[model samples]
Target: MKKPKQKKTKEIRTSLLRRLAFLDRATLDIDARTVELAFSSEQPVSRWWGEEI
Candidate 1:
């Protein structure tokens, strides 16, 4: 019996130096946690409860 041929796969990987280069290219000074807090506090839960009361 003949063995079946296996397919080859290509793997792509980013090096640590390349990742650091990307971080250095970013210019934004915004804090992710601060933005999350701002959005969460802006929701309508308080306003809805105020209208209900």
Candidate 2:
């Protein structure tokens, strides 16, 4: 016999929503558009010349 699958509980969903809300509030204080990209090393170039590349 196969067992039944369980759904996400209310507590777990509430906690996840709360964390997302906190992250949203935190990011609101920062200027994302003015942020600069700082790469220490050079980016790699893919050798494959496929359509997905």
Candidate 3:
């Protein structure tokens, strides 16, 4: 069976925008030039990576 999709509200979007909306022009420029290199998560080890937890 298929489930119905959830609806979005303006308030939720406004909240996210509020977090990204900074007043400092220099900070905004810094963020614009930044690039993500790598990331990691502390999940349980699995045999797929030759690790056991």
Q: Name the better of 2 and 3 by lDDT.
A: 3
Ranking by lDDT: 3, 1, 2
| Residue pairs that clash (backbone atoms under 3 angstroms), model 3 | none
Give me the displacement of residue 34 in model 2, in angstroms. 33
Total clashing pairs for each candidate: 0, 0, 0
Of 1 and 2, the candidate ahead on TM-score is 1
After aligning candidate 3 to the native by TM-score, how far in Å is the CA of 33 from where it should be? 4.9
State the lDDT of candidate 1 residue by residue for 1-53, as single tens digits. Answer: 99999999999785665212223324454665222211123334445348322
Tell me the deviation in Å of residue 5 in model 2: 0.2
Give the local distance difference test score of model 1: 0.43
lDDT value, residue 25 of candidate 3: 49
Model 1 clash pairs are none
Q: In model 1, which runs have C-alpha deviations exceeding 4 angstroms? A: 14-53
In candidate 2, list every pair of residues with a backbone clash: none
Candidate 2, residues 1-53, lDDT tens digits: the string is 99899886665333433212123343343556443333342445555583331
TM-score of 3: 0.21
